[model samples]
Target: MRSTYILSFLRISVSVLFYILLVFSVLFLVASIASIAGNDKAGDLTKKSYSYRVKAFGLQNTNEPFTYSQDSMVKYQKVADEYSVVLEPSSTIGYYALIMKLVYMALGLVILWNFKKIFKETSFRQPFKNTIIKRLRTLAALFILSDVIKLLDYFLFNSYLHHSIASTKFQLLTDVGNGVITGLVILVIAVIYERGKELEEENALTV
Candidate 1:
């Protein structure tokens, strides 16, 4: 039926979105681990140049106003040797990394659970209304689960970075943003599914 086709299309679209989220989550987890490992190092060259100034002038003298040619400042900044910190990984970052890994893993499992129906043969069709409503519910549950895991990660990391509670708070805000967007998408899907079901029932009754 026309309604059945519409439901099928919705199912396919939602499944694609789910897979996209799964891929993104996996990439984020990988990047987080790499960052924690110090694979991507970043430093302020200006800080290093300042250190050289301290060496040239005694620490107290260096604090005094000094002028440098623009060229000199540029050259020094460029020539500053890079140094690596012996960063013992923050328990906070490590905890976050672990949570990200777990979340992605769980998403993968869920995707696998749904893959057969979404990707395989086409004979198994529920009523258009029921099919869409069920899929939307599933998507909502997935996002909610992801959000919960993210909140746990934020809390664990924030607790460790308690000295800068501000930074932790900011991280929580960002996570909330992501969660909100996903939550909204889920909500929209749910509403549409329900409306479609209601319409289908009405149509049936009228017939």
Candidate 2:
């Protein structure tokens, strides 16, 4: 009974987050497209801003004793260990960034939906089902792919910056394989659930 209430709460939470993210994803996609298409305007309301975290130095004034690198494009404040770069939505690098963001958001939405599905189909009494196994496997794949996409996005954005911003050096900093671990754990659970399902069916047949 306690787990039932917990499941009910989680299902409701997932549902609410999913719909809210879904709406924002749609609006962002539309606005990004419009901003990319009409990039000739100097200042536009549709122009969205994206931010990236990187391992880079900050811009500061240099003295006679201590000199630091400065560039016209690199505008950053002194921070510890990392820097946050805010990029405007333009026709070049911004478009690709926006697309990657949308894709990542879509992956998150799918993962949440799969969780919602599993919670809907499962209970404390009977938690192992074929549908649950399939959904778990699906979640596993999505989690793995989400990490891959993040790496790809990082590389692509870094490459674009390397070529475009010649004066500044921006290194790519990322979590290399965090999601892979999570995905592997989920896959193991799915396998265990499959074995449990087989035993459950066997016991039913015997009874």
Candidate 3:
């Protein structure tokens, strides 16, 4: 009874969000195309750079303002530990940012698509199947991929940096890292659940 309530709630909530994001995704796609078609004036309204601060310890400032190096610190750690943070400029958005938005919206659609599908399965009171496992795996992988894409997008726009982000005012990357970890945990659970389902099917056949 509780699951029914929860399932109903999730189905309706996610369905609404799904359609809203679907519309946004289509808009982003259209806007991205227009930007590519040289709709520079219109594009300016939709895309802009953002500024953010990241506070990291032991950053060796290059003193030139925009460039900083953590080679020594990374060597000491024996890993590529970066003291870098890049944030979006709240002032203006551009072509590249519009493309990023398109990617983001598309990824969100993928997530919501799977979410709605999962809810449908729950609503039907269906047994777990291989397809469900695949869907769960996809959701987990997408969560991880979303974070990775964000990091990559930041680095790609490095040329846009007027200065480095070196403030410690509540680093947002930590939240992204947490998401990555959560995604991994979910992936593990999906794998385990899938295996259990397979075993149950096997036992049923043997009996």
Top-TM-score structure, candidate number: 2
Expressed as tens digits, the lDDT of each residue in 103-130 for candidate 3 is 8888888888998997777534446677
The most accurate candidate by lDDT is 2
Using alpha carbons, what is the TM-score of model 2? 0.81
Displacement of residue 192 (Cα, Å) in model 2 is 1.4
Give the per-residue lDDT digits (tens) of candidate 2, residues 5-117.
Answer: 89899999989989999999999888877766767764342436677787654445343343345755544455455667666687466767787888889898999999989
lDDT of 1 by residue, 144-184 (tens): 77777767765664454444333222223224456557756
Screening candidate 2 with a backbone cut-off below 3 angstroms (N, C-alpha, C), the clashing residue pairs are: none
RMSD of each: 11.9, 7.1, 10.0
TM per candidate comes to: 0.43, 0.81, 0.63
Assess candidate 1 and give its TM-score to the true structure.
Answer: 0.43
Candidate 3 residue runs with Cα over 4 Å from true position: 27-93, 123-125, 162-175
By TM-score rank, best first, the candidates go 2, 3, 1
Clashes of each: 0, 0, 13
Candidate 1, superposed: residue stretches over 4 Å from native: 1-96, 108-127, 160-174
